[model samples]
Target chain A: MNADEDAWERGSGVRVVPPVQPRKLAKVPFVEMADGRLQGVVSSGSDIARVYVSSITAGTHGFNCSTNNNRPCGGLGGSSPCKHLRSLVDEAVLQYGRERVARYLQIEVGEDDHLMEGLEGTRESAPAAVVFSRFLRHLAYLELPVTTEPVAEMHWFPATRAVI
Target chain B: MLGVQLAQLHDGDRPGVAEALDLVAGFDDALVHGFARLGEERAAALTALAGAVAASPLGPAVSEAADKVAAGSIGEEHLTALAGARTALLGAVHDALLDRLDTALGRTRAAWEESASTAAPADNLLSGSRSWLHELGITGWRGVDHDLVSSSGQTLEALLAEPRLRRLAVLLDGLAAELRASCPIATMARLPVRRWADLWTRAVLLSQPGARPAASVEPVTGRLLVLGADVHEHGTAVQVQVHGVLEPAGGAPTRLVRASVAAAKVDTIVGPAVWRLLAGHPVLLTALAERRSLDLADMPLSSSGDLAWQDDKATVGAPADPFATARLQLANANAPAVPPLERHPIRISEPVLLEDYETDGDRWTLDGHSIRVDLDRLPASGPLTPELVAASSACIGLVRWDAGGWRVQPLAVQATVKRKPVEAHTGDWAQGPTDPKVVKAEAKAGDAVAVLRERAGRLLRE
Candidate 1:
């Protein structure tokens, strides 16, 4: 069993599922796993899973996956998106609606890229920003309306949000 | 004596008759001194008098007496004739002096009557008295009086000795005494004696025939707002800024009035009433402003200082502690157990947040506006408290304008809290109720990992 699978097994029996609502995403505990990846724990009754998502890039498009039963679907480094990750993205769409979510993602991703050099690869130091960015991207992909115009500048996001 | 008789002839209507008499007395002195010495100077003095009385009844008699005296034909008859001529000549000069005085006095009285009838109350008194005193020219009071005596060429004793002038002086003295008793001397002392004399002259003129009553000044009516107030030490006085909206009787547009009352008249005049009015009890100020008069006939207002609104008639027996009386019956029932005399209300407006406040010894310095108020003098019942101090430091409140500074009232304080942004990883983040044991274990492991990371970094550097 892989580390992701082991982690899921250890937390499964004692897991407490959060309410299945978009607003409940704010209460979920997320941790930074690497420079561009974030991990979140999702539970259904007595079954628990660990979902991971990567930061968006111009060409790579990023990855999303989750552990099932006592094992990761492929591995911790899997590239394919998972049903659990899709569920979270659907929740984000329900919470923020289509247009706002898209704007939020555009602003967040733009700001992260701008500050990436100064961050010095210290993702763990800003776990909140990583989790927020992932949720924001999920909302953008699922709920945003299709538009021909390119995203504009990101000034609405507060400076404190970027600090984290 | 002849000058006095001349003055009495017309009931002292003539001005400067006494001064003319004084000049006659000087001539008598010269004659007596010249005769006692018996020299050529005496002959010269007699000859000058002979020429001066040439047109009078004694002219020929004095000229013949002078010839005998000049030829060394000294005898009792010649001497007696010369003395008699001198007396007759003095009487003739007195008559001529009275003629001039009559014309001057008529013109003066006419001018004074015109000015007095139309003058403002204070101006009427001042100008009328100044006219009379200028004519009398009494001296020996001091300062300005000395200058007047020197300028007018008269002595105090000579002016007082004249029965007619003495009577006028008595009348002026009575007026001065009345003013001194009714108003503070300190205020009057600020003016020159000539001004004071003018005030007394007006008083005397008012008592004379055809004198108009003190100018019927229209009392001001308005709403008075106290912009600021300050209480002096030991509750002796209070200084205040009064903002009023005065509406005239004939439906004139309302006008805003700003006036500052000095510390001298604060307690006795309108300060206490204004202070109380600003403290949210408007009974006294409202009554005074609305009625356009304050009937202090029964009130024990201080009679020591000059009132700011002297033009307004204040009848005796008005309410003395109007503010305190109103406050006691209504708002501040649990006020400090101090004598009413000790209470001094200071008005304040425009509450602003205080950034900070501190007390050092007996002085309290409030931040934000940087006001320093006397710790002991802050309004009673609103003494400094920890809550007030804390709120002052945290927020803004209304401060009162003092004489030249600012004062803070405890009751006028307001506190505000600042809003802050939410920080990450600070509060509970797990969605549902979690197992306590698991949570504790996770927290310990997290701490251990942080320690391990720090140790690894230090080791690598070494």
Candidate 2:
């Protein structure tokens, strides 16, 4: 290397801490349903995807992505909450209290009493306490060591192909 | 009884007059003391008695004796003469006292008449009540007599009660109270009456209804940053733009306000020197930047029509004459065609240093361009001084184009100090050291130029 490049390489070893992120989340277009659920579409360039925020249990929030093969989204695998779900819950708690959220959900479900009755036996078969215990067990697995080595050999590529 | 005894004595009756004379003789010492104390009034009384007795049957002897005493020639020192003059002198003393009382009464009547015309009833009541107090000979009327004090107090109270005069009275009272509080009572009493009257008059005038209070005008202050100056139509007019910060009294300074002055009004506003300096923009901008603040106190807000003739006069002088040699071309020689003279007025506005000056000729050099100044057009009696020439050397001159190159007939000069900062040499790779040979050549040229300038100056002086 040249003398200037050598000096720069020696200087670059000093640790650089990244700047702290702002508490305020970026604004996104969203709709509030009668059932106290939030639905929105977040687009990155040409890729548009629908996302939904719903409570798993009372006072517990979760989100799902329709475009992600009907999987739980926002880095949340159907258990622990993600940033999007947390942001939506924060916005809803700020706009409407917990009591109002509960009232709205009750009113939304009351309109379809017959459908709720059909699912009543299935809901009774799975107790809320057991589901909560299973969610906690999944969250504990995230902290356990899964491997001791690199998961895969990483490869680098040029961002764009150029004519030579 | 004395008058009856005198009458009897005058009719030559002996016993009754002799008894009265004996009684007067008994009071001789008292009479002498009374006459001595009375002085001039006693003399006047004796003189009147002498005149009255002259018409009486008392005869000329009695009147002559009284006249001598009245003239102060005879006194009790000559008891025989005094006794002979006694009847007239004693009568005069008694009559003088009565006359004094009558004169006092007359003066009182005259005083009443004067006061009746000039003083209101309130003033008379105050004066009349104070007359007795004045008789007591009190030095001041503040608290000695209650009637006089109350009367004066009532008068002041009534004056203060007047609607029209209330403000004036209050102002005066406040001033008086302040004076009384600050000074001794003797000093307040001794204050000059005329000064107090003047103060009162001014206060009244100032406090008059509809008299607008004097407006406090704060002087305008600013920093004038001259941006550019354009000398239009030669040297007749100039247009100048200046960026300034105006600091009004009791207000924040407003920045970057542009003020432009026209050339025709320049002479009357800031005079010709500033105008010439402004017209030569680079020097002015440099000086303004160096000085930071411009003193615009000499600049005027309105034009006075003084420099209106400069533009017209610039176009009016004698026409240029071609050299005689230009006319003499040899036959068969290929000569250049004579071009028509351009009549368009050419103006040069630049700062120049007058290196050489003389009555015969003068030279001004600006940015390597040297021009001859026509000095014959200057007023003959007023010769330019060395200091004036040196000062004018650094000034801007207006030159016009003519057949004989550029000529400056009327050069406007302003007195100003040129500030040049010392520049340090910063080493840069692109620049190289100057050649010593070129520097030597430039120095030789400068010396030659200086010698030529001195020779030209000497010639001009001659």
Best by TM-score: 1
Tens-digit lDDT track of model 1 for A1-164: 56534332222011111111112332222221223232343333233223333232212234344332233334323344444444444444343343333332332334324322211221111233344443332222112111111010000000010000
Alpha-carbon TM-score of each model against the true structure: 0.17, 0.14
lDDT of 2 at B64: 64
Count backbone clashes in candidate 1: 23
Task: Please give the range of 10 consecutive residues that has the lowest summed lDDT in model 1 chain B.
Answer: B423-432
* Regions of model 2 farther than 4 Å from truth: A1-164, B1-345, B348-370, B374-387, B390-399, B408-462
Q: What tens digits encode model 1's per-residue C-alpha lDDT throughout B314-353?
A: 3222322322222222121111111111111121222222
Per-residue C-alpha lDDT of model 2 across residues B85-186, encoded as one tens digit per residue: 444332333233222322321211111011111112233323332332222112221222323323333333443444334323333333332222222223
Docking class of 2: incorrect
Fnat of model 2, as a fraction: 0.00
- Candidate 2 chain A: minimum summed lDDT over ten consecutive residues — where? A150-159
